[model samples]
Target: MAPRPNVVLVVMDTARACETVHERYDYLSELNRLAQTGTEYTKAVASAPWTLPSHASLFTGTYPSKHGAHAGHKHLDEGIPTLAKAFQDGGYETVAVSNNTWISEEFGFARGFDTLYKTWQYVQADIDLGKIARTKQGTEMIHALATRLAEGNPVINAANAIYGQFFRKRTDDGANRTNKWIREWLANRNDDEPFFCFVNYLEPHLEYRPPKSIAERFLPNDVTYGEAMSVPQDAWGYIAGTVDLTDRQLGILRALYRAELAYLDRCLGELRRHLEAAGEFDDTVFVVTGDHGENIGDHGLMDHQYSLHETLLHVPLVVHGPRFETGQVDDLVQLTDLAPTLLDAADIDAPELRDASQGRSFHPEAEIPPREHAIAEYMAPQPSMDALRERVGTSTDNIERFDRSLRAIRTDDEKLIRGSDGTQEFYELRNDPEEATNLATERSERVDTLETMLDEWLDTFERADTSGEVSMTDATEARLEDLGYLQ
Candidate 1:
């Protein structure tokens, strides 16, 4: 019998569909080329708007409520089954390389893989320094001597700290390191087991500083690199109405984000070439998708929080392999369904995954029922209001406005967003693609129907038993802060 095909899941963190799709950017030639040989889902929606919960839904074939990872809770319930665990149990070698701190082993995202590399650790100079400054007396003596050299001068000490934190870290978001490690691992593995590799590229997430060589090609004529670098990375301040960005700042941010997307496309092309060179291209199932999208001045928001509009929900999903047919699928699909589809491809049967998941298979050969509507949930504010207040150094009137939770359901034509604070928003997606108009008050009957459908879906939610605390290192906290997650 032929060996089972390998599976590779690549997540483009915070990539929005409006910009990354083939129709939008000419710089995404690699991604567009890959789509020609695979199926691209143009209407794929995320289960949540942010990272942790959206990823939890991606790992498990369940929604955020079922997985119990959101703003209210940071830990994914340990009892839930993960896709990596299922593949490992099915005899495939599982490995993961992630640049995001939230997807690290500390958060239970590494439970299923044989080896999960936190690429951020490799980029930090202090982690490398720790190797030479071990606990032994010889190492301690060297560390003490180095510390004493810059001990007295406050300016020197500040400069050293800045260098250790920012100047020494990789600005590419570890994509280069991730590819190098994957190629090395593929070359060294002697076993013939089909491998499951999960990779995440975070270059487009925030602080969108693409490499200068690539950024120059995508920047607008009026935007300068200095202007892009000067744009505030503080989404919280902007959302709270405490800080207002000038039009010039917004333009700089948009240009830099597009540059990052172009860079990501180049990385994807490099990865595919590596797989082909390793003699595993044709036998590998490649799944390229985004966890959720960012809000770049959409709905007056700078980050992906406090809203469930199309800008945050709509994402790009492309599947390529021996099992998937090559074409475009406009069907409404959820990211949660990917787990079942992959498991079906590998012929692995895990009752836990099936029983726990709310998703259906989209495999061409599978006889699954059609989806009527797509659902997305957003729990109360992430980087909580208190955290926002601390970051901006004062309270604003808009703080209370975003404290409520949100749930949205969308059909092919219309969408309804309901908030826990009794607010409702309705949009006709075909006519108002930008979601600029609200018909909640104008069309009462249609709003009621969508609300009822949303209610029925909410009733099926069985909240997972997620009761635990997260313990993170100081470096991890600092990295998260740099990403604008923490204050």
Candidate 2:
């Protein structure tokens, strides 16, 4: 039998399809080149709208509901087999470099990794004692206090205004740092053993302060980080109709986001160059994808987990390797499909999943059946909504709507979003790609059929026994709060 090819999975955290590849963003040249050389799934969907669950789906080849690693259930069950374990069982070395705390070893994400590098662990080591509290426990307490003080106090707000500027400088860019580590690993790893490398790049996530050189390329010379930070940290003020931002300020925010993407693109190019120099480029299967998309003021939401809109669900999935057909694939695909596809590419059989994974390999040369629709789930009682409402008053109806759990199903031309509160929204994607209009009332028949299909599809997965809030260390919780995952 032929030796398995080395696998490299790149997860661009908070990267949106509309911003990265589908639109006129020329900064991602390397990714574009990969898509041209390989296969690009034009319409790929994530199984969840946020990190933990979406990433679990990608690693386990199952939906958030099946794997039960969503907001309702904060950890992946140990019983569920992951793609890393499958590869390891088949004699492949598995390694991971994750930036998000939710993907840390504490959460069962390190189950099969031979070498796991958590970027946050390194960040904690480099933290300045003066900027943050002296001790880890003290820092956690300060974070909790800050959360409380941020509610409505003018003094705290003023302090936050000042602290926000320095905060951007406190942390190093995770994507660039991770790429450096990957290059070092390539130099040290065994040449004979095939390896699976999982990298999570956090450059595109919040607090978008690109280096001055990168930022200036996108913005005017006069713009500064202070001007960008002038907009509310989470833009909750804009969402709740409290603070009004000038047109120039909004443009600065967009510029910062684009600048970060540009930085990420450069880092990706560096990784590609390193792989080529090591003579591993030809023998490696490269898969680049986004865990979930972000909402940059789309649908009046600042970040993800607020809504299951296309801005937060549609992500880029590009694959390049031997035996893969090149060019664009128009069929609908999910992030969950990536695990099985990677395993299949290596000629490895998938392990017996707890709730049989719904993903199928997209090996283009093979006669695999295409999916007609894609599903995404969001189980929310988002803690951020309360903080947003407290800072800026919003309607109770809006709050209720944002708090409701949601499930979405999308076809090539249509989408249905069903909320737990019994509210439904349907959009004709061809005409309303932005999802500006909700036609649920007008297209009752379509809604009914889609809802039935969603229900039937969901029925296949066995319900996980665990369902509750995730337990976290004080320091971990503090880190999540700093990242805006906690209130």
Candidate 3:
């Protein structure tokens, strides 16, 4: 038998499928090229709309309910087997280069990694700068310092003001830094052994600040980061109709997001180049995908947490390797499937859990039945809701309205989103791709059928016991706050 191929999983944090690979934006040129040479599951859905749970599902090959690393329980249950663990058990060198703090050693995300290079450790200064910039007082203090530094030269002062007000100094180039670490590791690793590498890039997440060159390519003449930051940080305020933005401003936000994607595309290209130069490109299996999608302005929400809309659940999945065929699959797939698919590619047996893996391999040669529908869930604790409302000064009722636990089921042509508060929405995806029209009231039969399917799917997984609370450090909380996840 041929030697097992190396596996590289790149999880692009908060990248929407529509923006990255879809025709609308086409911002990820490098990824698009890789798709041409591999299989692209165009309709991949994430198990959850947020980071921790979705990543847990991706690693565990099960729903968020099974692994139970969500808002209520912030750590993955150690009993459940992870993809990295499977590879490690199979004798592969497991390495992780993660930018998201939720995927750190403290969260059980380092279970099977031989070497884990967390971006935060290398970029603490950048994280500190981001935390400082998120507050009004901190922004004012930075502005004062910039003003003082630019007193000698008028041109230098103007540049400093723009830097202080609009440009965030990114001391860490997220994926670029991770790629450098990966390349350095590859140089030191033994070529005889196969490796499983997982990388999480945070370029497309909140407080979007792309390079100026990239930002100018997509944005209009007047759109500025200073202006975009002026909007309320609390997405609930906008969802509750307390904060309003003009269409042009929303357009600017979208442009900023696309620019960030563009910047990430370049970084991915750099990583690919490094792999090719190392002569390991052909022998490696590469899976590039997003943990979850981001909501730029969809459904009156700013980031991803409050809704299971297509903008948040639908992510881009591209699998390239010697074992995979090169074609596009329109079949609906979930992020949970990635774990099994990757394991299948590596020829490793998936570990058994309370529930059998809900994920099926998407490899073209696999004889799996077409997935009928995909489900996504969201659950936020009452304390988190209260804290967010206190920070944003929004009413508890209003915040809770959107923050309630909910489940959504989406088929190829239709989608149904139901909240714990008895609010439900259904859309015929073919005609209402944007999901603007809610058909739950009009189409009773369709709602009943889909709801039954959702309920049956829910029955397959046992709910995890989250009685043991997981606490994060103060620094971790501050980082999440800067990313707008805590606030």
Quick one: best TM-score, which candidate?
A: 1
lDDT of 1 by residue, 1-487 (tens): 7688899999999998998765456689888887888988888999999989999999998998788888777877689999999999999999999988889876679888998887755332222222122232566745653664353553443444444345434558888878888889888985578999999889898878898888877677776677678778778888877878987787778888888999889999999988998999899889999999989888999878999999898998988998788788888999999999888877789778877888888888788976889999997678777888888787767777887899999998899999999999999999999999999999999999999898788788777766444666555566677788963
Task: Estimate every model's Cα lDDT from 0 to 1.
Answer: 0.82, 0.78, 0.78
Candidates by TM-score, descending order? 1, 2, 3
The candidate that achieves the highest lDDT relative to the unseen native structure: 1
TM-score of every model? 0.91, 0.88, 0.88
Candidate 3 ranges beyond 4 A from true positions: 23-26, 123-173, 222-237, 240-242, 351-356, 381-383
Q: Name the lDDT value of residue 238 in candidate 1.
A: 85
- Tens digits of per-residue lDDT for model 2, 1-487: 7778999999889888898765356677888888889888889899898889899999898887778888777888898899888888888989999878788776779888898886554332212122233232456846745664444553544344334334423644567668777889999988988999898888888878788778878886787766665665555555556666666776787788888888888888898898998889898999888998887777777768768889988899889988876778889889888877887788887567423677987776546798889999887655546665664666566565677789999999999999998999999999999999999999999999999999999887686666777776555666666667754
* lDDT of model 2 at position 184: 91
How would you encode candidate 3's per-residue C-alpha lDDT over 1-487 as one tens digit per residue? 9989999999889998888765445567888888889888899999998889999998888887777888888898788888888899888999999888788877778898887876654322212232333343666856744544444554444443344334434633367678888888878889888999999999988778777778878878776656655645455566556778788878887887888888888888888888888888899998899999988678877888778899989899888988778888899999888777777787887556213567887766678898988888886642376676676676756676765788999889999998888888999999998899998999989999988998888787688877555876544666676566663
Where is model 1 poorest over a 10-residue stretch in terms of lDDT?
Answer: 124-133
